[model samples]
Target: MEVVAVGGCWCDFVSISPKLPKKGQTILGSKFLTQHGGKAANVAVTVSHLKGKSAIIGRVGNDFWGENRIKSLNELGVNTNCLQKTSGHHTGIAMVNLSEAGENQIVGIPGANYQVSAQDIDKYKSIIEKAEVVVVTLEIPVPSAIRSLELSQRISILNAAPAPENCDPALFTLPTVFVVNETEASIFTGLPVVSFEDCKKAVKCFLEKGCKSVIITMGEKGAVFGSDATSDPIHVKCPQVACIDSTAAGDAFVGVLAYLMTYRKDIEMEQMVEAACYCASYSVTIQGSQASLPTLTTLQQYFLEKF
Candidate 1:
């Protein structure tokens, strides 16, 4: 069974500076670039970089932007058999601003993304059924995400970045892995991320809510993984590096985790966490979302040089 990724796609406009401005403060960017970035598409590209078979299922507008995104996804070796093209609505787009301190702010317009329907999931039911792992993200409409999530009984990894509150509470009931950043973890668990111990408590809250496993990513501080089903907290530290734009660290992490799980069923939770951290670190050294992800060979060389 291969890995099938389902969700939204967006063309991102990005700018970078040393610090994000406060209300009423205007700052200039040190650099700027536009790239294709939607959590699902980004992860699919990451999976391909790991030499894994990946198929993307979602919607895009009938416009030039949407056409280009499909072309790009195809170029990355991701099968686009399920990417839908619509008329009228423009492709989804995002404005991402990255600060020199590795912080980022984004505003997204969910254009054609809002149109994904349950029928689409039914169209890909066979692929979902055969996938070793099925991945989904919240960038698409919640109903669409919920529909896609419901179609798969395989290992499901949900990268709920810029997390949403309206996702079906039933999503927590699936035999799924809930991956969220610290801020997102706080939102889902309603707790502040103040210390390492607090991080464990936050994950516990999610497990109590019924998720099979929870991963709370604390940027630079590392990530914490495990749940009530596991015996101990698998704490993995990220490699220290000179920071640049951190735009796609979380996406890279999710993609790598899914890819590694395809080959290593009994992979130590710590091993998976560390590989993800390494992938995230590699992302910060470059710019753009999918563009910055390292190939398996590149990542291997990176660790040999750093360690």
Candidate 2:
């Protein structure tokens, strides 16, 4: 495997509302759709979309949705042999509410997702060891992620999301790169990330935790990447686009990042991050998770037309 994504897999039940509902309010939605989701699953699908060899290790319910999740990943060309089905649990699920602005509010019920354990990591160690890069997310338990980090042979990307209230400081130092979107950056470091200067301050805070490198995705403003080895931090600005659904932008970024780390190992980090930003920016121009991701052929066409 070129990349193995370890985390959660869920069925997303999405609805488009005029606005996100507030406390004690009832609202009507314009549209509804059921789609494939889960942070790690989204990452794997993104890698496969880019034609990279990808696998996913996680658990789902032994139910209809679980079967559908596995089948979809297979159709997308992601290896699903390592994904497991839990007997007594329901497949993980997320109720997604999207506003016309393309912003989303999600409430996830982590059924079999929380079932992924350290023992599961042991069972999949060989698969995990074969990758040049292993992408992980916090949608699953912290201990399982820790176990994967301990077993990973080469590069590991810990996308610390849904930010933990109490995190093991060592998690920041374990991976080849620690990635977070602006909201997560603010949560983990207790610093507001509203400006480029704020992102730099957050970068300093993360690097001081002993990471070799860190990348913060700042949405429409683009992203910032830095390394402990170099004092300079690189900021790559994204091209403007008419945004639709912003839900999977980070997954697109992480997916492209993992893909380049696997197949374009000799490329400089700055170039890789820039490509990821472009891919993520493109994802927002469409709607739906996984479905919005661009294939290698499509992305090439997009570059020709847009660039």
Candidate 3:
């Protein structure tokens, strides 16, 4: 496999509301839809959509949601040989609310997703060992995440989203690339990331903790990149666009980065980060999770129109 993603497989319940509701208030939504989601699953599907060979190692419940999750991955051409179904437990569910401005608030109930075990990771050890890029997220059990990190042989990426309550210290030292959003950067570094300089400091914090490279995604401002190879950090600014929903923007970033690193070996990390930002910025302009990810053709057509 070119890329292997070890994390959660979820069916998202999404509502496109005119505005997000306040506490103890209700609001009518403009529309609603359910689609395949979860960080790892979205990454895997995006890789496949970009014509990269991808595999998913995760768990779901023995329920309708689980069935649909597997069917969706299969239909999308993601290798699902390692996707397991637990006998008892619901598949993970995400309640996603999108404002008209494309902002989002999400709460996830990780059901069978939490059932991903270290043994499951061990069972798929061969896949992790052979992949060009191995990606993991925090949606699955901590043990499983740790095991995947331990087994990864080539480039390993840790996409630490839905920020951890108490993060594992080793997580900083293990992955080749550690990615987090600006808010998450503040949380992990205990420093406010309000400006560009603050993001540079956060990158320093992760590198000191032993990460070979770090990326701090600053939402609409774009992302910053740092690594052992340089003393200076690089910031890539993205284009602003009219957005309808932004549920899977982060996942899209991770997936595109992995696809480029796996398929286009000659591309530099800076260019990969730029391509990722470009594609993820495009993702927010559309709706749904995997549905929102821009394909290679869409990306080509978009930039050709813009430039």
User: Which lDDT values do the candidates have, in the order given?
Assistant: 0.83, 0.90, 0.90
The CA lDDT at 183 in model 1 is 84
Lowest lDDT block of 10, candidate 3: 298-307
lDDT for model 3, please: 0.90
Better of 1 and 2 by lDDT: 2
Number of backbone collisions per candidate, in order?
Answer: 1, 0, 0
Superior candidate under lDDT, 1 versus 3: 3
lDDT of 2 by residue, 18-95 (tens): 888998988999999999999899999998998889999999999999999999999999899999999999999999
**lDDT per residue as tens, model 3, 1-307:** 8899999789899998889999999999989888889999999999999998999999899999999999989999999999999988999999999898898899999999899999989999999999999999999987789889999999999998767878888888888899999988888888999788999998998898888999999878999999988899999888797877889999999999999888888868888888889899889999889999879886566447656
Clashing pairs in 1: 17-100
